[model samples]
Target: MSDTQGKDGLAAATGRFDAALARLDQSLVELTNRVQRIKRIEVDTQRLVQERARLATELDKTSARAKRLDDSAHDVSRRLVVAMETVRAVLAKTE
Candidate 1:
């Protein structure tokens, strides 16, 4: 081949290489952005999971407290009934 033709071929090849490199750079940038977005989503998901766990723990504590309150109410009701029976007996004796 003539020197001129060889030089032209080299120039064309170099241009193609440069274009390919530019495309590669662009793809790398896009990949990096996607990875960053994924990381953020992962962090958000973890936070939500932790919050849900904390709320569940609070709910369990509230349920236990409610159970205790119910038991106390039942005990009070029993005592009130016994007092009323005693009062009725005393009134009958006096009458």
Candidate 2:
């Protein structure tokens, strides 16, 4: 090949190499961004799982308290009925 032709071929090859390098850099940037997004989603999913567990514990405690309250109310109602009967018996004896 002539000197000019050799120089021209080398320049063309260098241009192609530079273009390929630029495309590789752009792909790397995109891949990095996608990985970061996935990490953020994972963190968010873990947070939601923890929150659900906490809420379930809270609901269990509240249900236990309500059951105790219901039992106490039933006991009070029974006592009230006994007292009313006693009052009625005493009034009948007096009459």
Candidate 3:
């Protein structure tokens, strides 16, 4: 082959290599962006998990407090009934 033909072949090969490199670079950029988005999603998921745990703990404490209040109310009601009965008996004796 002539020197000119050899030079033309080299030039063509170099052009193809440059195009392949550009495509590879673009693919790498896309992959990097996707990875960053996934990382952000993971962080959000972790935050949500922590919030759920905190809310669950609060719910448990509030339920216990409500139960205590209910018990006290019943105790008060029982005491009031006994006092009313005693007053009725004393009144009957006076009558």
lDDT of 2: 0.99
- What TM-score does prediction 1 earn? 0.81
lDDT of 3 by residue, 1-95 (tens): 99999999999999999999999999999999999999999999999999999999999999999999999999999999999999999999999
Error of 2 at 56 (Å): 0.7
Instruction: Estimate candidate 1's alpha-carbon lDDT, on a 0 to 1 scale.
Output: 1.00
Q: If scored against the real structure, what TM-score would every candidate get?
A: 0.81, 0.80, 0.81
lDDT of each: 1.00, 0.99, 0.99
Better of 2 and 3 by TM-score: 3
Select the stronger candidate by lDDT from 1 and 2.
1
Stretches of candidate 3 exceeding 4 Å from the true structure: none
- Steric overlap count per candidate: 0, 0, 0
lDDT of 1 by residue, 1-95 (tens): 99999999999999999999999999999999999999999999999999999999999999999999999999999999999999999999999
